[model samples]
Target: LKYIYLNAGKINYVSNLFFFQKDILLILKKYLEKQDTYKCFEILKTFEKKLDIAFEKEFKNIIYIYLVITFERIEKGYVILKKNNSEFLKNTLYYKVIQKDIFKNNGVYMYEALHLSEYFLSGYNSENFYEDRFLIDSFICKLLSVLKDIKIRNLINNREFLEEVIEYLRAAIYRVKNNFILNSEIKLDEIENKIFIEILQYKIKMNTYLNEPLRDEEFMMISRIIYKHLIKQKKEKIKLKEVIQIIQKNSKNCYSDLIAKELLELYPNLIENDIDFKKQLGLLDIVTEKNIKFTRCVDIKELIDLSFNDLYDNSFIEVEFTESIHKMLEDKKYDYLDSENMIIFYGKELKYKKELGVSIFFNESVMKIDNKKIKYLILLSNVDEYNYLGVSRDLQKIIESVKFKELEKLNSEKDVMRKFEEVIQGGESGF
Candidate 1:
């Protein structure tokens, strides 16, 4: 067995003729076992560098597996290398890369490896692969947690696809756990949040009934309206039934590609394009068919702010904290009006019974004021930093307080938060 020793700068030296010879590998391992701990790593680096130099030119046949362990040095960027020279290689690739695409100086790892990650995720910035097992495990722990989001989970819709993705992630995780004995000090809060969000999305996709019966005219109006809305928002690939539900509020929007594609998979038919239908209408003048004027805005800010006008009516939803409810608020426009003493509670409150409450605002802030000094607990809008503190008695009193010059001059959002703290601090209710 010819063992290959990982030499210094061998990666730079070897061009394109590198091959993994198990016999050579066995010899190198024997040599490393005889050397000191410090010298063991030197042996590995020498082999890696040598292989890099050899695989730069001509077609090369080498080892089938290049396992890497990334740790502290490169933010845990690890990689696994495999040969791709035939039909089997094409099928194995996460991403396809034709030969003509590799004309640059940083040929193999830089361009080729990155493209390959589209199907397989070994690590980020995988240039820092080394023999350090400990470092690899630590980073892999964080990565697996982060990548557990809906985007990753949704990548595999069915059982087969799910199995494939799990297989890749599992291999990476297993390699780190077994090879690199790194510390697992990742944030639990983040991991839980991501998992919850992923699950919620999965549930939504797996279950929801999205529409109702409507006249052909109403259906056409809905289709046009949905097209206009999605176009205005510049959103694409949205479910047709979801768009339809916006027009039919009573219907549930849970249609799936497997169950039904709705408008996306339907025959084309326009209401106005049919001439025979128009002739059947005897009382055409009495039938009102007014086209509603639609407004289109390209500015995201304007579009978001367009949704902010609902905070004055005291119409808000109560959110409980259990079952990862916080994730349900994503991609929504709601004002959370939190006062020091509001009756609503959201997250920590739901679990283990804490004071973390969530008052989703659809209208005016809801808080009952008595003697509490609004301290610091307040609502935050992801859209912007605007927060509405529950008024002493509603917007009317708030307006009056400002008019009477009783309320001190302050930033609106700041004033709201402060007042919210005061109300929560006090033990009062109602306007």
Candidate 2:
């Protein structure tokens, strides 16, 4: 019987012992195969008045078809039963209607009716089965608990977001169980910014109740949800003139003036304060050497440690770059010019870090001049708009000026250190 049931879709075969029961069995089979669960519910309701032991031919046949399919699916490992309890089917409107109007609250008969409806209305797929409701509910509870800890529960307080999250998680569990692939349209890193990734890490830490790590697609989807609900709408509006003035004071060059002109020409909305300047700064700060600051000499490791400690104190999160100057030069992974001795990277300092809408830059240098190794670090803060203002070009010009004039004076490492100290002290004679 099981073999015949499993092969029903393939061979167009029916059991001879059930020949007289063909019509109802074929109707139930058609409904199950096509996943027309509502039709199955209608048919199940028609049999509510019949006793289980003395069911009418139509009711008996539908029950037989359902039993065979359920047993076959179980044998084939298509159904997984969790040991948790759930009252979703019993509490549903359909179940209530059947109990009140048809079963008349007869405990014995109501149980049978519910059993039949659970299989039929849920489409007989393990993914849609009532028992899995416990798992989904548990997952949602865990998710809510984690969100509450992060003070982000208010963002998802509406029904639409809740339903969407539940649907996404349910689909994720189904895909995981079936070994299916779920692709994300956006790259994980592109949408998963530092704060978003932090939230996800917290989620992962809190999701210990789950049996497995979540799929990357699930993480990406959840990140997108957080981004849409929280980050996108909560962007800080900063003063453009204040930021430009800071850049001018820090650099002490026409570099800020050049950037101001370019900004006015390129992004007039900034002057009018009509847009989120922080977002604009993020885009503008892509230049290689923007927000330049020269610092007194220190050992390489000490410099990195000091920079890391200072930034950490100031609400800056460090995103470690894989390719250091030594690694890059040793592996020849990237083309480096002979004169290109320094590397720098920067990112926005999130509100979670310190003052909201600020940016931080880290510059690391390793210089080898005349058998002496010179190491130093420069820290730039709140100047992400420098790149758009031609700071990198201005920096190169300054480097050229220093090389042409001060290189001859710097015969030893101590001379280089003295010159850098002079620059830090606002002396007239340093780059």
Candidate 3:
């Protein structure tokens, strides 16, 4: 029978530690052909929500595997055998709700249904998971609120760590509710702040989940997370203050410039305090202001008349971007350009790296390249190897924008720069 054959394949599949053997893979592929993946995902998402638990982030493949196996078995009339005398639990609200809501139409029998429901609740009910989630959320909220009360609001602004703490509490709550005590080498006394411990203990006692206090291991882990987070916050503040002082001084030294650049990247919101400093930080962005140029050039002949030296820091020469030249540049085989008499390159060809600076030739009149007329040429050369990639990506986006084309017709540098800023601000693309 097909059911027996599939069961034998499944046994092999499980024996291989869930790695799909060729036969099982074939069966899964056949099963998935008639199944909607999205539907399976929806059921999986529903199950997670009902249980108030998440699978691992990359759980889709595993979910689909299990779903395929389970459904295929059911399709072949291989429902789980109902266990005798478990009818009392089958009548509970948790079991009833899950059965009705999740598996009512499915032919998953009593044994399977009971096991599925029990996987989430253990001996408890659905209400327990709901209450546990609420209690955990309230605990985190109150702890954060206490920080606010003590005027330590700045540390609370570390949203990344705050989210980590929230997720940690969620896991801790699950463990505590299930009476799964985590065994850890961490000691509660290791935390230096007695006041912090007392505050945490008070918060824990006040907002206990499921009539159980968090185990010593869980308590110490949570305390360590908070303590480390606070220490990191203090260090960051000191670093920021030092960097700001170095930048605020009337010095244009390399050391100060480097620190300013790093600080700007780490705390971009600091730009709100100083507009001029923000403009200086603009170089940190892929599109540097000094590199953009608006010019009038109708043909290749007109290129000679343009002041290439004033436009870019690197020397410029016009050369055809031949297949060999492009290949040589891509392979980083720079020996071909070793001759002093080698021709210089223009803006659009700068990624080939004959030069090192930014140049945007926003030509008012169309220029001919390989006998094809072009509106603009973007030349992005950078000492940083990865910088060209970023600049090219931004340039490609600008070229794709209809607004950028309109700016080209106007031939206004201001409008082009404003459009760049708009893109940087993550405004609507249509604007």
Candidate 4:
């Protein structure tokens, strides 16, 4: 004999399962209303098995919060449809099925709900390719811990830097894991470079998530960010006179006045000529020109290409060429009249039996001459004191002045020679 629910008491017993589910939902709703996020998470955990298959164990909390917040928004009639027209999300049958079945609230749009579901599924299933909030947050916590231990935490904007770093790390980690190549144009200063290496080394040692050594470009990107932060901190602290002094001391032959002038042009309020530096020693460490000639009148490519042998071979004053310059010419590193435009050597050269110092600068670029693209190499040679830093600084200034039209106009070998002589004579007058 079968027992039938013929009375109200029987109906209560038969519907006990529905009431239990309803009780759980009521508890979840109360947690949400109270804004007790942790309790809401605990309640979600209890009904984890009933959630969509796309919500993985690791991302269950995140998906649950997303769903609860989205449901709350729907109830408030404030559904926001983010613009994501990803073909992959649109083409997936799982996305379509979920859109049709789970997110059937009257207020939520079909595609918008599908997009959120697809995002959760992609993040969960493609763990190797993408990083979710949990992974990123955990990585950030560990990173901050290491930074704190290193004692350089105060040097950066902790919150801002970490947020940016987390995003970069997420992308970087995925690329590194998959052995992908990334290209970057960023370069770091010496101090920042050292810091980058130290930070990367520490991260590699401490973080198990980063399983392999990062590419140079990846390191460059990180270093660039750190360098920018360092620069921002140092900008106000760096005095113009101090920077000039640093350059003067390092360059050895550069005049402080010239350094001051160049620096003022680059940064107007950094230095004044009459300022006294009796007590303070500058802390900026930078690379500066020490043993080169600077000139503006002559093209570098034209100067290198000039047949030194043809011009000076018959002259009364014989020029003794150094073996280093000879090797450089043979290697075709410098721009020559009949050779490819290449720059291999640039520095002070010993000329005239090593008695007078000659500074040579060779830098190459492509330019349009008569509407045709031509490889232009610039050469600046000056006779100065051996390893004179002033010569290089002067040459750099001159090169900076050379315009495409000016370079294109002087095509004759005689004109090039005259321009070279003019630059050398002009540079020597200042010294």
Compute each candidate's TM-score over C-alphas: 0.16, 0.26, 0.29, 0.27
Question: What is the per-residue lDDT of model 1 for residues 36-125, given as tens digits with 9 covering 90 to 100?
Answer: 434324433433354332221111111111222121212345433443332333443233322222212334443343433321323311
Candidate 3 Cα lDDT to native = 0.48
lDDT of 2 by residue, 9-47 (tens): 232336543343577667656655655334334444454
Instruction: Give each model's whole-structure lDDT.
Output: 0.28, 0.43, 0.48, 0.44
Candidate 3 residue runs with Cα over 4 Å from true position: 1-128, 148-152, 188-196, 208-212, 236-431
Q: Which ten contiguous residues of candidate 1 have the minimum total lDDT? A: 280-289
Root-mean-square deviation of every model? 26.0, 27.2, 22.3, 27.1
Give residue 254's lDDT in candidate 3 (0 to 100).
49
Query: Candidate 1: lDDT over CA atoms?
Result: 0.28
Q: Which candidate is the best by lDDT?
A: 3
TM-score of 3: 0.29
Ten contiguous residues with the weakest lDDT in model 2: 354-363
Off by over 4 Å in 2: 1-129, 188-191, 203-206, 211-213, 231-431
Pairs with steric clashes in candidate 3: 317-344
- The TM-score that candidate 1 achieves is 0.16
Candidate maximizing TM-score: 3
Question: Per-residue lDDT of 303-345 in model 3, one digit per residue for the tens?
Answer: 4234344333344333343333344333332311111111122
- Please tell me which model should have the higher lDDT, number 1 or number 2: 2
